[model samples]
Target chain A: MSIKFKHVSYVYAPATPFEQKGLDDVSFELKENQFIALIGHTGSGKSTLMQHFNALLQPSSGEIALAGHRITPTTKQRDLKTLRQQVSLVFQFPEAQLFESTVLADIAFGPKNFGYTDAEAKKLALKWLEKVGLPKSIANKSPFELSGGQMRRVAIAGVMAYEPAILCLDEPAAGLDPKGRHMMLELFKAYQARGHTVILVTHNMDDVADYADDVLVMEHGRLLRHTTPSEVFKDRAWLLKHGLGQPAASEFAAQLAENGLPLLPQPLTLTALTHRLVAHFKGGE
Target chain B: MTKIIIGRYIPGSALIYKFDARGKLLVTFLFVFAIFLANNWPTYLVATLYTGLAIMGTGLRAHVFWDGVKPMVLLILFTSALQLFFSTGGTVYFHWWGLWLTSTGIVNAIFIFLRFTLIILISTVMTVTTQPLAISDAMEWLLTPLKWVGVPVAQLALVMSIALRFVPTLFDETLKIMNAQKARGADFNSGGLIKRSKAIAPLIIPLFISSLEIAVDLATAMEARGYQGTSGRTRYRVLSWQKYDLLNAGAFVVLLILLKVLG
Candidate 1:
């Protein structure tokens, strides 16, 4: 289902001496099966905005509609719990949230809290672990014993076990090696393949360019632009002004274009860049 | 949901800071004991004046010194009222509803209240003047002798230091969780006790989960650094008692004896 926020505003430590306005009249919508990437500099309210998607953060003065149901402070407990389950959130460092004795138990925590039977929860856990490319053998071991990447995989498995319609990941590939990062992105691609709506919050422009179907650029608690990757990349000056780095491959293409080579459309990936260069030499004939 | 309070200890280079932590600890204990022993007006007056001067010497404001007294206000008032009604052996001021207020009772209440206020104020001075890490370091060093008795003093101090560090982090996390739950239409404010408590359930679940994560990260960091229960570890920061500490301790003891003799 789609998630909608109408004019959301949030403040950290409201009315206290430490109070800081984190979001200012922000509004956006995530349509069903849409893969959106939220990118901004640190403390630009990107995290604050993403938190609102899963109902982790409430707007100080706006309304939210999840799956066509109006979300309010007086919403029923059962309804809120179900809403949270539908929009699963895997935090930036998922491994930090591991607490149960075994990977299986940690994965089952969310489902069990929502009243899943033990046996049923275990079955779901096993399936999600495999879905994340981890084996069932890792299920019974303490989550603490797993390597960093494995821990993250199990943590994602825990969220995937809930089978949310909307999967919101906060910096999923953060702190991973290059290979680990690629594997994690591939997992999100698989999730998208299954027709699940994914909202990925990241700072890496390359990740956004390679995977994000929709890109929303935020700067200083303000949404500067919300459009497709091509549209966002077209505004090169604006992106640079807001502390956002351009995709490395696209930067190279732009440099080539400056050197009297017309690369019609800048390529963001290395493979596409290679193809474009080959065509330029062939087209020279 | 651990109702943790922030620790006092401002870090700065000052004369009071250079003193050994063990010396400071010993001196504080002696000062508190001496303050408690002052029985009469002259002794109490002298103790209060000395403490007030010492508080000013620390370069902290009077407000900082008074913070310790704030939390004990209710207890001080209660104890005063109890003394005014229950203490006997003096001229009676009034009698009503099985309660008697005597002249001695009034004196006792005033004395006890002043004593409570002054002592709390002095302790507040200690907390504000010393850095918490420094104090913990001092505590660990002083308790090293207890290692022979299998006392995990260093470990205890490490736990305290870590807990203190985590307080602000956890508080920020708690606020985030609360706001998130609130966004989902969970009313933490404007509800009955049960309803408010119920509303906090979702927030607490995530907060606890995050805390577990924090604990694991901290443990991993500790393990990575070769921490294995503080055995045979040489401290980077060493503390030493100086001549000033010896004089300070002796002066305090002499002052206590003088007060007792005069009383």
Candidate 2:
């Protein structure tokens, strides 16, 4: 197993008036190279669960085994250093974490921290900068001077430069325009295509339908469901009751079926929905 | 993390919470002054009991008070220990290797500890009972006289309030940066003093940059909302003195006079 959480739970500010249950008896397993989408409403403990993957947070109860490291409440901080190098998390608004003087230096910061030499780090930074679609000429400028989208790209490149075996992102495409969002999602998909695990926490069901292979649904700090996107989105009424929206294609397919225009199966993606409609029209002809 | 009670206002319906922020601020100042004025054991005991009563009156939990005192435990102990060994007076209770533990030393240490505890407890009670905005408003009102002398009192108060408000926000930002760096294999623990300080550079730089960005954003937002830097602003929540505020102030003066007479 690449990642396994066995009855894990977490509480924030335990034993105080502000104490809150952030995660409740969550248990799941994720295999290697799987593109997993973690979906939940705000404050549903999605971020808290993702932080456990890299040992940024330890489970308050039970245990988690990620890439062979068994993490419990008593895990030593020193043991997490290697785990962090293997599982990198790109937090929300990660661009704000850029602090190096130049864009190149900022991108190289991660690789260098992970033991890459100056020249090697810079080389990797240059490679990833281009891969993230930024020009080499802007590498020497301050990241703060860049536009919002460019800064996000630079920040993402910084994490990608280190190239962890498992990548976890929290709302990576949030606040981006459609094009930027598409580019970001495509970049992550490409990363997963290279045989690496990608765990994405996002609210966009369309992105889930198009990209994610497996889906983990969270509700009120509990793991309500863990299945494929097709399976999870198929239960439209259940998803709606849980305050989750279905993919547009699936909802439209459901409406069409309700109107007596039957599709063979629910189409989750635009291409699948289009193919189904074309076949229906040909059959009518 | 829960132990961080400073700058956090706990809501309550106690008399202390009901008193005006201005009256509370003045009383806090006077209380701190009264603490320093207590040089004898009797006076320190009275101050400690009074501060304890004041803390209980605020309706804050006992542990919250202990949380504030917890960090200062070591300092208090160290100071008391120094006084216990070095202070020379009264009958010697025990004689050790070139050191005498005397009655006066014991009394002095206890007096010092009680004084420190009382002062810290008073301040903690004030901060916990009064909201930060109320404190800032009180500060602005108290500093209004400085405007005649050309001090930007309103601006200063605004800056103070903003800074106070961002304390928790910046704390969270620091945690986020630290987590980001840690994910990159930066170890904050397990290092020498210099190494750890160097590791902190990653956290501090991001924090400073992000704080500047947040400041710029806040300024833009304020201007967008037509904040004229106190020149043309009208009060939304105006502060008015109540009868309890006068009673509270009167009670503090009475306590001060009583302490003087008894001590």
Candidate 3:
């Protein structure tokens, strides 16, 4: 099922001096089982929009349809556990949410809460632990005893253990090393391959280009565009206007095209760029 | 989380809002002592009238004052109920295991409830009308006499203001942490005492860690901004006494005179 929004808007501290329009009458339909990238600069309502996916923050006006549930401003917090079980949200710096004594226990937390038996929770936790690239040996250790990156993985695994049909992440790989970032992106890509929707919020244009089949571009509390990633990166002027960056490969291809070595159907990833470059040179030969 | 409007100030343009922060702070501090001066019905009535006038002067709706009283209502009722049940004297209404309701007990209970409610309402009036920054500034100005005793008044004032600011920040942090845990299917509100506490552990740990991180970051940022403590600093917000501020103090003096004469 697709997630749908109709005239959703969110206001922070309404009717007060500190009142601000967090999301301004946004509307979008997101299809299931696709990797969707939510891209925007700071204070563009990306976080606000992410919170709406699982009814963490209700719309100030209008309504949302997530799975079979209808969420309005009156959707109480108690009624949202079912929705949250279907869609897990990994907040920015998810590591800070860790409180379980052991990494294993922490990873099993979501599954346990979602009604999995201890054995079943443990099995899922161990499975996702290795899937997220953590060592099995670290499972017994206190989550606090692990490094920052390892703790982040444990926290991510914690939410992923229940195998929610939809996973929502806000900058999940932010602040990681480049190698770690690539591995995390690959994991998310693999998770999406299992026919579950993965909605990600990231500033990295390259990741969006690499993994995102759909791109939702937000600006100043408004959804500027909801289209394919290539279409989004195609407009260099719009990206520049919004202070957004380009995927390195597309940018390089654009420069190559400008220098009279055109690679048609612009490359979005390194692999695509390599193939395009090889074909262009081979065709030249 | 509790709706704590006790220390919250709503900014508005009113006569009470115009009173100098220093005078308001002083009056509020003395009012605590002044409440005790009301021993009899006449004195209590005078105190109540003064409190009523103060509330009216704020130009705020009654609900704001009601909110100030809501949090302490249970405690006041419980204490008043205890006094109503226990304590001895004239005409006995009830007798139990070493606890008896008497005429004097009823009077004391009523007085206790009145004193607590009036104190909360009047303080609420002061807090609601004055900005937190103004309160801190007034506190610093009032404590200036302690400067000769080697007190770090400016630093203390800075600490007090920062603490006041963190109250809201900590509350927001608590909310964020609670939501994060709730996303994981941790049911905080629908459980027995033990289960509820277990659910809340996630929130407290994260909140505690984040607060420490925030404090450290704040200290580093302050150092980066070259915040040297209490050295050659000039006041950006100066406190000056106005005619209305004098009227505020004068009004209190008149109330105290009335309280003494009538009680």
Candidate 4:
């Protein structure tokens, strides 16, 4: 397994007046190169769970094994650097983390911090900059000078430059235009294709349907379900009862089946729905 | 991380919470001044009892009050220890190398310690009971006379209120930045003094930039809403001098006078 969480629980400000249960008895495992989508309502501990993968937060109880490193509540600080270097986390609005004088330097920050020479780190940053679709001309410009979307891409490139073994992202495409969101999703998919584990926490069910291989549903600090998108979205009533919605295509296809169209095997992605409808019409003719 | 109780007003309907912010401010000022007038054990005892009563009247849990006093405990101890070892008067209890532990020194230590504790407690009670908005309003009203002498009292009050409001917000932002940097393999805890200071760049630069962005956005929002810095503005919640406010102020004044007479 690339990552394993065993009965992990995290409490913020434990033993204090503001103590909060961020995650409770959460256990799961992910294999190498698997694309997992974490779906939940706001404050449902999705971010809290993701932070554990890189040891940014230690589980208050239980343990987590990520990329061969074991993390528990008493995990030492010196040992966490290896875990962090192996599993990179791109936070919500990752653009907020960019702080170097230039875009190139900003992207090079992670690599250099992980023990790369200055020149090698800049080279890796330049390569990832192109991978994230940012032009090289802007590499010399200050990151503060870039647009919000462009700055976000630079921040993502900064993390990707280090080439972590397991990449975890929290709403990586939030507040982006449709094209930007599509490009980001495709970039993450490509990263996974290169044999790295990818865990994504997002509210967009369409992206989840299109990209996620496994769906982990979280609610009220607990893992409500861990299944494939096809299986999870098939139980529309159960998902709705839990205050979650199915993918747009899946819901639309379900409505068609209820109205006597009978698209057995509900379609999740738009392309799948279109193919199913085209086959139905062709078979009818 | 328990919301940093400093300068925070817990919402409640206790008698202390019901008192006007202006009255609380005036009483807190008088209480701080009265702390210095307390010279002997009896006066300090009365002062400490008054503080305890004031805190009790707020109906806040004893622990909440203790949490406020917790950080100052070390400082109080240090100040009292300094007085105990240094102040030279009365019958000497112990003679050490270049230091005298006398009965008067011990008394002086107790008096100074009680004075510090009483001042902190009174200020904490005032802040915990009164909202920042109310404090700003009371401040502007109290400082209105300064406006006659060309001081921008209203603007100053607004600045103070905004600063108070951002304390919790910036604290959260700092935590977020620290976590984000940690996720990127930035080890803040393991490094030495120089390495630790160097590691602060990632945390501080983002915080500074985000704060600037937030300030700009707030300024734009205020300008859009026609904020003109106290020019031709009317109060939404005007401060009124109520009966309880009068009582609260009168009670504190009487207590101070009694302490003075008794001391």
Highest TM-score scorer: 4
For candidate 4, the per-residue lDDT at A241 reads 91
lDDT by residue for model 3 (A1-285), tens = 798999999988787645788899999999999999999998898988998888888999989997788999998888888888998899988998898889999888889899899999999999999999998999899998899999888889998899888999999999999999999999999999999999999999999999999999999999999999989998888899997988999999989989888888988999999999898889889
Candidate 4 lDDT over A1-285, as tens digits, reads 667889999888776556789999999887779899999988888988988888878899998887888898898868778778889999899898988899999999889989999999989999999999999999999999999999999999998899998999999999999999999999999999999989999999999999999999999999999999999898889988988898999889988988999886789999999999999999999
True contacts kept of 3: 0.65
Which pairs clash (backbone N, Cα, C closer than 3 Å) in model 4? none
- Shift of residue B215 alpha carbon in model 1, Å: 9.5
Deviation (Å) of B253 in candidate 2: 4.3
Which regions in candidate 1 have their CA more than 4 angstroms from the true location? Answer: A15-17, A69-79, A141-145, A177-179, A235-237, B1-5, B8-82, B93-100, B125-131, B137-263
Candidate maximizing lDDT: 3
Ranking by TM-score: 4, 2, 3, 1
The DockQ ranking, best first, is: 4, 2, 3, 1
Best by DockQ: 4
lDDT tens digits by residue: candidate 2, A41-116 = 8888899999999988888998998876899999988877778878999999898778888999999998998899
Chain A TM-score of each candidate structure, as shown: 0.95, 0.98, 0.97, 0.98
Error of model 1, residue A246, in angstroms? 1.9
True contacts kept of each: 0.05, 0.64, 0.65, 0.64
Residue-level lDDT of model 1, residues A140-194, one tens digit each, is: 8988789988988887887788687888888989999999899989888788879
Error of 2 at B232 (Å): 4.4
- TM-score of each candidate's B chain against the true B chain: 0.82, 0.80, 0.79, 0.84
Worst 10 residues of 2 chain A by lDDT: A77-86
DockQ of each: 0.12, 0.48, 0.37, 0.54
